[model samples]
Target chain A: MSTGYHVAVVGATGAVGTKMIEMLERTTLPISKMTLLASKRSAGKTLVFNNQSIVIEELTADSFEGVDIALFSAGGGISKVYAPEAVKRGAVVIDNTSHFRMDPEVPLVVPEVNAHALAQHKGIIANPNCSTIQMMVALEPIRQKVGLKRLIVSTYQAVSGAGAKALAELAQESADLLAGKQPEELSPAILPAGSDKKHYPIAFNALPQIDVFAEDDYTYEEWKMINETKKIMEDDTIQVAATCVRIPVFSGHSESVYIETAEHADVAAVKQWINDAPGAVLEDDPSQQIYPQALNSVGKTETFVGRIRKDLDVANGLHLWVVSDNLLKGAAWNSVQIAEALHQQGLVHV
Target chain B: MSTGYHVAVVGATGAVGTKMIEMLERTTLPISKMTLLASKRSAGKTLVFNNQSIVIEELTADSFEGVDIALFSAGGGISKVYAPEAVKRGAVVIDNTSHFRMDPEVPLVVPEVNAHALAQHKGIIANPNCSTIQMMVALEPIRQKVGLKRLIVSTYQAVSGAGAKALAELAQESADLLAGKQPEELSPAILPAGSDKKHYPIAFNALPQIDVFAEDDYTYEEWKMINETKKIMEDDTIQVAATCVRIPVFSGHSESVYIETAEHADVAAVKQWINDAPGAVLEDDPSQQIYPQALNSVGKTETFVGRIRKDLDVANGLHLWVVSDNLLKGAAWNSVQIAEALHQQGLVHV
Candidate 1:
C-alpha cells in the first residue's frame, strides 16, 4: 500500500535540511512517506533517505501527523512555529523561511519563477531568498522577455548560506587563517550574521553584512533582495536593489546582476532569453573563456547565467553573472522545486 | 649636495613596485636620490629603503639620469618600454600602467580625484586603475557634493589584483582546497585574467572575469571600471556601468557602488560627503556593524566609505561600499599620491 505521498522534511539536520534530503532523493517526488523533522537537538539523528535510514524525529505540534508534503527549512523560528503546525496537519507548507516571505498570504514561490503561485496555496508556501531564489532564477527569463524595468543586485554570497554553523565558521576561519591565526586570533562565533551582533572574519574576508541592519540601512540580507524581488516579480512597480556580500565562498551564489529593460533588449535577445529560460543555465561565452562561476556553481540545480553584457549607458541596461547552488539552487533545490510544483499541480493530497 | 628630488622606483621588485618603495618611504616627497628599477630578472634584487639598502637597477635606455619623479609599476609591457625611456631621460613619468590610460596625451590622475589632472602632464602621468583608483577616491566626494548622474559598479576584486603571482595562486589554491583537493585537481596557473586564455581557481571561487574580454562582452576589468570612471571624473557625460569580479581576496578591492546624483543626495549628506573627502574613509555605521570591509581595507591608504543607503527606488539613487588597498589606494598608494601631487603642484621638475 505504499503508493507514494506523505512526505515531510522540516529541518532534518539542516544545511538546508541536508539539501532537503538530497532533493527528496532525485525528485519526481512520489515519496510514500519519509518524515525526518529535527531539533530537540537533531533528535536521534540518522538521515539517509531513498535507501532509507531516516530516524531524526523530535519536532512537535504533533509533527504534521499525516503530512502530504511539508519541507520547511527550520528557521524563521521553525517556520514561525511549525508552519502553522504543518498547515494544521493537512501539510503543503513548502517554506524555506525569511518568515513566510513577505506574507501576503505567503506564496513567494520560485518554481522557476512563480509556479502559478502554487495554486494560491492557503496552507503556506514562501521559499524565496537564498539571495532571492537565485535572483528569481536569473531574472525570470528577463522578466518574461524584456519588461523588467529596473534592478541592481550585487551578492557573491556563500558560507553555505549561513547554516551548518556557517559552514563551521568557514572551515574554522579558514584553518585559523591558514594556521598563522589572527583575524583577531580566531573564534568567530559565526558569520556576518548568526544573529548579527557583530561577528566578522569571514576568513580572508569581505562581509558587508548580510542580514541584520534592516530598513533604510538595508541588510536583512538587503531586505531580502529588496523584498523578495517585489514578491517574486509580481511587480511592485518593478524597481529593486540589493548588495548582499559575504564572500570566501564555500558553495556558490555569485550575483552582480543589474537590469532595467522595459523594451529594447538585445545582447542577442538576452542570450536567447537566458537560453530559453526555465531554471536557467546559459553559461555565456566571451569567446571560450566561458562565464558564470562560483566554484562552477557548486552542486548546481541550474541558474548559472553569465556575464551577459549591454548597458554601456542604460539603453535598456543589462549585465549579469548569476551563478547558483547555495545549498542547491539556493536552499534545497528551491524547496525541491516547490515540491515538484506541488506534485505537478494536483496540489498534492496524500 | 643632495637637496631633494631624484626618486625613480619603476618596477622595483613588483607588487606595485614594492608599494612604490613603501610610498617613497612615507611620502612627504623630498627624496633626493633613490632609483631601483627592475626586470633583467629583477636585476640583482635588494629593496629596504629608509633603513637604506637599495640595489635593483637594469631597466635601461639609460635609467632616467636626473630622475625627478618616475614611479611606474612594471608591466603594460614594462610601461610601453620604459615609459618613454623614463620620459626622454628627464623623468616625470608616474605611469602605474594601463598603458598611458587613454592617451589623448595621457592625464588620468586620481590624486583624490584629479589632483588638478596634474597640471595636464605630457611627460607621462596616468596611474588610475587599481579598480579605478579606489573608485576615484570613493566617487570624488560624491562627485563634489552631488552633481554627478548615473553610474553602476560591482567589483569585489582581489587576488592581489592578479599580481604577486595572483597572490601565490590564492595561497596554493587555498591549501589545495583545504587538503582534499578537487577544483579539478587544481593547477590554476594564474587567475581569471592573467593574460586570459583560461586559468580559474580563484580559491573558494568567484571570478566573473576581470581584465581580458573587452568591448560588449565587457571585462578589461569591466572596461577599467567603465573607461576609468570617465577619465577620472572629467565626466564624459557621467553614465557608466561595470562588473569586474575575482574574489578570494588577498588584498582589498571590494566595490558594489551604484550612484545617480545630479542633485537630491541625502543619506546624511552622503555620510557627510564621504566624511569630508580628501582620500575618503567613512566606514558607515549601520548601527555599528560599520561597513566597508575587504579585510578592513588592507594597508589602507584611505578610500573606505561605508554602506551609505537610499535608492529603494531611484529618486536620485545611491549606495556605496567601496574599499581600497588594491595595492594601496589601488596601485602603490595611487602612485605615491601622484608623486605627492607632483610634489605639491609645482608639477615636480628637478
Candidate 2:
C-alpha cells in the first residue's frame, strides 16, 4: 500500500460525507493528512476524525490542489462542475454522486461487483446509488454463478439518504405524530424527492416515489438501479423493475429482491453459493429466526442477505432480502473502497 | 333488500372486527337485532351501535341460531371452529379468516373483483387477505379488459393487520426510540408476525416476513396472496409472486404491483379502465404530484391506484401503486360488502 497520500472529502458536513470521514478513519488507506471540504455554509465547522478535530474548508476548484484522492458526495450538480476540475488538478476523483455515472468514460462501480472497471476510469470512479449498491453486492455473486435474466425489487429506503435535514424531518414528524398532530399537518420539507412538488411525511408511512418521476413513469432512482445494475454488471439482457419507496428508517436500506436466474439451480446449491460469496453475508436461517434487517445492518459495511426462498411456481426464480447501511456500503464506504482499489492498483494519481 | 334480519359480528373487539362494526353502521344492511360476540373474556361488555348499547355475548355455536348474516374476523382457528356452526345455524357466514379461503366448497370473494362468486357459496363466503383485497380491487378491472399473465407484488403492510395490540406496540416502540432508547432495548411485543419465535420493532423499520414461513420459503401471508389471487380470479395458469412486509403504518396497506398482461394496451386506456372500475379510485396524476398514500388511505374503503407506468422495456408489462385501509377494504369492509351482495342477490338467508 502507498504511504502518506493526502485525501480530501467533498461535502464533509452532509450525512454521507460524515460517514465518509468515519469510514476513512477505519479504512486501511495509508493517509498522512485528511482535509474536509463542504459548502460555504459549513466552513470552519470542525469534525472529529481519528480523534483529531479537523476544520471543514469551503469547497472550491482550488480544494483539489495537492490532494492525492478526492471523494465527492455533495450532490450531482457540485460533482458535475467540480469533478473534472479535481481531475485536472491531478487528484483522482471518486465521485459519490450520479453526475458522471452514466458517462461513457466514467465507471459506475460497486467495488465488490466490478472493481476491474476501476482500471479504465479517467480519474472519476462513480459510486452506484445506495439502494443499487447493496443489491449489486448481494446479487452479483448469483449473477456470476447462475446468470440473471430478470429482477423485481422493492426498496424500504432510509430518509438519511436524502441528507441530514431529511433525517431531521423524520424525527420531527415522529414527535409531531406522537403529540397527536395530524399527518397532513406535518409538512415534509425534504423527502421522496426534495425537488418534487408534493412532500409526504415519512415518519410512519411509505412513499412509493423516490427521486423524481422520469420518462416512462419510473423515478430516477428506480431507473438508476435498472441502468446501473446493467452497466456495472456489463449486461443489458437482464430485465429489471424497481419500486423505490422511502420508509421511516434512519440509516439502513432494505430490499426485497426477486430474481429469475437464466440457469436453474437447486435451493441448497444457491444457498451455498451465497455463503461463499465475497462481501456478502448470508443470515438466512428460518428455524433460528435469523434474517437480514435494517435495524441490524446499520453502521455495517458488509451487505447482509437472508430470507432466501425458491419460488413456488417458477423453477428458476429466487428471492433475497438484502440490507445495508445506506451511508456506508451505499455511498461513503463505497467511495472510499474505490479509492482503496485505486491505491491498491497503483492508479491513484491522475 | 332484507329488512329486520338479525346480524352477528364475531370478534367484536379486534382491529378488523372494530372496523367491521363501523362499516356495518354505514352499510345498507337493515337489521332488527345486532349481536356482538367475542371471547368469554369480553362477554358482558357493551358496545354502541345505532345509538343502542348492546351487551357483548360470548362466541358459541348457538350464538348464530337466528342470525341471517354472520361476519367472522377472528383467527383461522376460531373461524374454522365456529364458522361452520354459523353456517349450520342458517347464517350466511362471511368468514374474514384464512380457514375457508381455499376450501373447495367455499367461495373466496372480493366483492369488487368477484361478487358473482358469491352466487355459488355453500352458506359461507371467504374474504381475501387484506393485501390481496386491495390489489384485486385495483387490478381486476384491467384484468377484465386485458387479461393478466403474471404478477409480482411487494406489500408495505400496516401493523393493524396484526391486530390492535400490534398497533399499540408500534406506537410504544416509536416513543421509546425517539426518547433515545436503544433499538434492542425497546422490546418488540407484537409485530411482523405475532406468532413467530422472534419479533422485530416496526417503529422505523420494515419486516420482510409478515406471517410464518410456509412452503418454498414464502410466508403464509405471501402464499395467501398468490393462491387467493388465482382462486378469486378463477384462473390456474397465471403466475404470481408475493413478498409480504410489515411497515409501521397503523391501518393502510400499500403495494407495489407489477403485472404482465396477455394483451398489450396503452397507458391511457389502462388508466381510463381503472377510473371506471368499482371499489377502485384513480388518484394518479404525475403532473400535479397526486398519488395514493397509506397515510391518506386511512378510513377509506376504496383501493387507491396511482403511479401507473408501462414498462419501458417490455411491451405488455405494467406497474401500479395500490393502497387502501387494510382494516376497511382488507377485512371489515370486504366482509360487509359480501353481505350486501348476498342481500342484493336475495341470498342473505342462504
Candidate 3:
C-alpha cells in the first residue's frame, strides 16, 4: 500500500488553487493530512473536500512545518516567496507559476511528456505555462517518432487562463453586450494583459495579444511557450515560434500547431502514433466530421488532438489541432500529477 | 468630365450582393444606371439602393446587354454561365467567385496591390478571395518595400461570410447559449463548409476546417488564400500556406500572418509602408496597448494592420495581424473599386 503523507495546498482560494483541491481529491496519491493555505484576506474561508470542511490558514513560512508536499499556484511572487520556504521546511514544492521553470535545478514536469525529469528535482518541481503543458502532451509523442526541427503555433486561448475575476469579467461583459451595451463601454478590468494599464473585452471578439509584450515583440505568454518547450523537451536546438491570442470562450484552449519533422512523415503513421501515445486522444476523422473541438474538451484531463494535415509545399511539414481544459491539464492537475509522479516513482519521502 | 457607367449587380438579394448595393451608394464609381439581377427564386424581391427600391430581375444572358460593368457575387455556377455572356456583350465582369480567379485570361485584382494587372484583363476581373484581399491590402506595401518570400496565415473569420442565414444561425445559437442551454444541442446548418454534409456550431467556438478539406487536408478556403495570394500579387515564387478557421463574429475577418521578407527588414520601415499604403491603416502601438481588432473593423472599407514583430528565429521573418470588414474591402468595395478604376481610366462608357 502507498504510504499516506501530509500535504499543503497553497493559494487555496484562487481559481487554479481551487482546481488543485479538486484534482487532489481525484488524485491517486495517498494523503493522511491536508493543509489549506491562502492569503490573509481569504484565511477564514472554508472549502469542502471528501465530506470534510477544511478551514483555510494564512500562508506563512512556518505553514510547511509538517507538510510532505506543497502545491503553489497563487502567482509568481507568491511562489518565489513561499516556495523556497516550503522547501526549506522539508516539503517538496510543485509550483504552478513561471517562477522557477527555467531554473536548472527545478525540473519542469509534464507527467506524460517528461516524468523522468522529476527524478532530478531538488525539492522543487516546476509546472509549465498552461499553453505549453497541453502542447507538450499533444506533440511529445510525435516528436519522439519523427525528430522535430521546427514548430509554429497559434493559439485560441480561453479567458479562464487569466484568472477567476477575468472569467467574471467575460461573463458580465458578454451579458452587457447581449443586452445592447457597446463593446467599447463594457468596462473591462482584466484581459489581453492583466498587468497592463488597459484592458479589452473578450466578448464576441478576438485579441491577438496575450500577457504583456516581451523582447522581440513577443508576448511573455508566447515566450513561455517558446522557452518552456525547449526546457521541458531538453532540446534548445528546436526552432519554436508562437502567436497566442485570447478568444471569448471560458474554458478549453485550442492551438494550431505546424511542425517540420526531420524525417518525411505520413499522416496515417502520425495518427497511429498519436492514438497510442499516453494522455493524447486522436479525434480526427474527416469523413465523419469527427475532430477535437474546444467546448468538447472542457472538464477532460487528457488532451484532444485532431485536424491533422500535411503541408503541401513543405515535404516533411505537418499540422495538428490541439485542445485541452487549461485549468486541469494545463495547470492544477499538472501540478498534482507531478506530486503523484514523485510518489509513484518513490522520488519523494514524507 | 467623368462619365457614368451603366452597372449591373448580379445576385442582388444575397448577403454580399446587398452589401454591394450599399457600397455603391458610397462609392466613387460614376454609376449612371443600376440593374439588379438574381436567381429566379429571388426575382421579385425588392432591395433598396440609394433610397430607391429596385425589384431584382431574374438573371439571364440578356441582362448585361446594355451594361458597361457587371459585379457578380452570385455562386460560381451562375458566374460561369452568365459571366461569358456579360463579357461578350461589352461589359467588364468583376466576379467575386472562384470560377475565374485562376484563369490566365482574367486579372485577379486587389487594386492597392495590383491595379496595373487590370489593364491586361480580357473583359473579366476576379476579385480575389475575401481573406486574401485583406491580407494583400496589409502586406502588399511591405512586399513592395522588402520583397516577400514566404507567408503562413491563420484566420479568425466571422460567420457572415457563410451567408445571411449563417449569420442568423450564429445569433440564434448565441442567444440560446446565453439562456443556459447546452452548446452541443445547438443545431448548426451551415459552417466550415456549407456544401459538406456536416455542420458545426460557431457560437463560442472555433471551427478549424473552412470550405471543406481538399488535397493534403488543406481546406479549399485555405487553398483560395494560398493560390489567390500568388495570383493577385503576381508572384508564383512566393511560398504561401493558410489555416482558415470560422469564428463566432458576425462580419469582420482577422488573420495572424507570419511572413519571411526577401531582404533584412525593420519593424519601423514596415509600419511606415502600411501607414502610407492606400486602403491600409496601421494600428500598432505596444506602449499604448493599441492593435487592430476584428469588431472595430466592422463596416469599414480599409484594412487595419497591427501587432507587427520580427520573428525571433528567422532573421528576415515578420508577423502581422490584419483585420477588415470582409463584406466591404474584401468583396463589395473591391468590386466597386474595380468599376471606379475602369471609369477613371476611360474604359467604361455610360
Order the candidate numbers by TM-score, best to worst.
2, 3, 1
Per-model TM-score, in order, reads 0.40, 0.98, 0.96
Candidate 3 lDDT by residue in tens digits, A1-350: 24687889999988899999999999988998899999999998899877799999999999999899999988999999999898888899999989999999889999998999998888989999999999998889888988889888889998889999988887787778777888778898899878998888888889988899878778899999999999989999988989999988888899988888988889999999999998899999877778888878778899999989887777887889899999999998898889889998988753
Q: Which ten residues in a row have the lowest lDDT in candidate 3 chain B?
A: B341-350
**lDDT score of residue A166 within candidate 1:** 82
| Candidate 2 lDDT tens digits, A176-206 | 9988999978988888789978788988888
**What residue pairs clash in candidate 2, if any at all?**
none
Task: Quantify all predictions' global Cα lDDT against the true fold.
Answer: 0.82, 0.89, 0.88
lDDT of 3 at B93: 92
What 10-residue stretch in candidate 1 chain A is worst by lDDT? A341-350
Once superposed on the true structure, which residue ranges of model 3 sit more than 4 Å away at CA? Answer: A1-3, B1-3, B40-42
Shift in Å, residue B102, candidate 3: 1.8
Better of 1 and 2 by lDDT: 2
Q: Which 10-residue span in candidate 1 chain B carries the lowest summed lDDT? A: B1-10
lDDT of 1 by residue, A64-110 (tens): 98888888887888789788877888888888878878879878888
In order, what are the TM-scores of chain A for the candidates?
0.37, 0.98, 0.98
**Over all chains combined, what TM-score does candidate 3 have?**
0.96
Fnat values, candidates in order: 0.86, 0.67, 0.53
Q: Order of candidates by lDDT, top first?
A: 2, 3, 1
